[model samples]
Target: MRLSMDLELQDIPGQLLLALQPLKDNKANIISVVHHRERKTPRGTIPVRFVVEMDRSKLDAVKSQLVSLGVTVVRAGEVRFIEDVAVVLVGHILDSDLGDTINRIDSTGYAEVMDLALTMPGVNEPSSAYLRIRATGKAEIHKALSILRQVGEEKKLLVIEPIEDEAA
Candidate 1:
């Protein structure tokens, strides 16, 4: 059976490894992991998404083991997150408290920032960033981008939203 779970882990070194150890102990084979270390949830916790393959009978045991390791399983079931969105933020990103902006978008539970890249030309020049976000569905992805745009506007930054393809 294929299972997807969302978990909350303490923001510390090796915490992710520690959380995964329980699954390994239970003989669960990890298919993929979407780990976001830069953003924290509203509860001040890092969220992790795990895709694992295991027998249905072992599902309960896996949950128990994860809980024993102080990991909070946010959601656990068969559904997978299949949507993704990317946006670019331009103009003085660093000076506007980039961390706070990222945290706000991540706090919305439905979406997470999967990657970020920042560029700065000089001390007085503007900084730009490319952010890749992942969400469970199209609606959630749009909501995340809207939140990010709001943040950028408040900080006097320019946001380049994703353009949809005409023939998709």
Candidate 2:
């Protein structure tokens, strides 16, 4: 069986290795891992992605082991996040508390901010960023976007909603 897990690990030495130890202890074979050290979850935690192959019956045990190790499992299910949404934020992202904004969306537990790109003109000029968010369902995506919009409005940032590609 193929399983995908989203985990939050502490930003410290050997934390990633500690998080992976559960899978090894449970005999789950890892297929791929996408670890982002630059980007963090809403709680200033590192998000780690893992694709593992193991016996179907051992899935629960692997999850249990991960939990025991104090790793926060953000998502663990058969239904993958097949939908993507992109939004652009134009303003002083760095000064507006970007970490808090990201945390609000991630705290929903239904959506994840996958990628972010920032463009800074200068110290005095306003900055802009493109955020790619992924959610399991349309409702969850809307919820995340709404939260982001609220945060932007509160911070006086310009939020440009994504235009869906009709051709896709």
Candidate 3:
């Protein structure tokens, strides 16, 4: 099963590798890691988010190993973003409160903006972006798309959803 972990690591050399040792020892294959250098916990440790895959039986052992290594495990749970949808936004995307647009869908608790590619022709020209959104299920995906469309309408941007023929 896929899992995710939020960890607080010591700000020192090899700390990342040290923190990852538990995942390796427990046979969890690393998927992605987002090391937030700019964010720190109250103790001044760095925050690291990891996505991984492993057998359900190994999860507890991995968590225990992580704690033994002095790594603060903020959260550990099964991965939830199982459905993916593609969308496009056209017009002055940057001017239309892009962050708000993304946040509205994410704040719904059913979806999130996973990846994005943006284009800008000039300082005053309209911009566009391709977004990859992930949701908990197909119904949640449609709701997220609906939210995106509403945001687009309010911001005077053009919203383009994925073709219905495309597989989720």
Measured by lDDT, the strongest candidate is 3
Question: Candidate 3: minimum summed lDDT over ten consecutive residues — where?
Answer: 135-144
**Candidate 1: residue pairs that collide:** none
Q: How high is each candidate's TM-score? A: 0.53, 0.53, 0.53
- In candidate 3, stretches whose alpha carbon ends up further than 4 angstroms from where it belongs are 81-86, 89-132, 135-168
Q: What is residue 163's positional error in candidate 3, in angstroms?
A: 22
Better of 1 and 2 by lDDT: 1
Q: What lDDT score belongs to each candidate, Candidate 1 first? A: 0.81, 0.80, 0.84
The better-scoring model by lDDT among 1 and 3 is 3
Q: What tens-digit string does per-residue lDDT give for candidate 2 at 1-168?
A: 666787889887888898888789778777556676667877888988776777767777777887898888888655367778999999999998898888887655557789999999999899999999887555567767888999998999999988755642
Summing lDDT over every window of 10 consecutive residues in candidate 1, give the lowest-scoring window. Answer: 30-39
TM-score of 2: 0.53
Question: lDDT score, residue 45, model 2?
Answer: 84
**101 in model 3: Cα distance from truth in Å?**
21
- Model 3, 1-168: lDDT tens digits are 777777899999999999988888888888667787877778999988777878888878888898999999988887678789999999999887889999998666657899999999998998999999997556568878999999988998999998876575
| Model 3 residue 36 CA deviation in Å | 0.7
Better of 2 and 3 by lDDT: 3
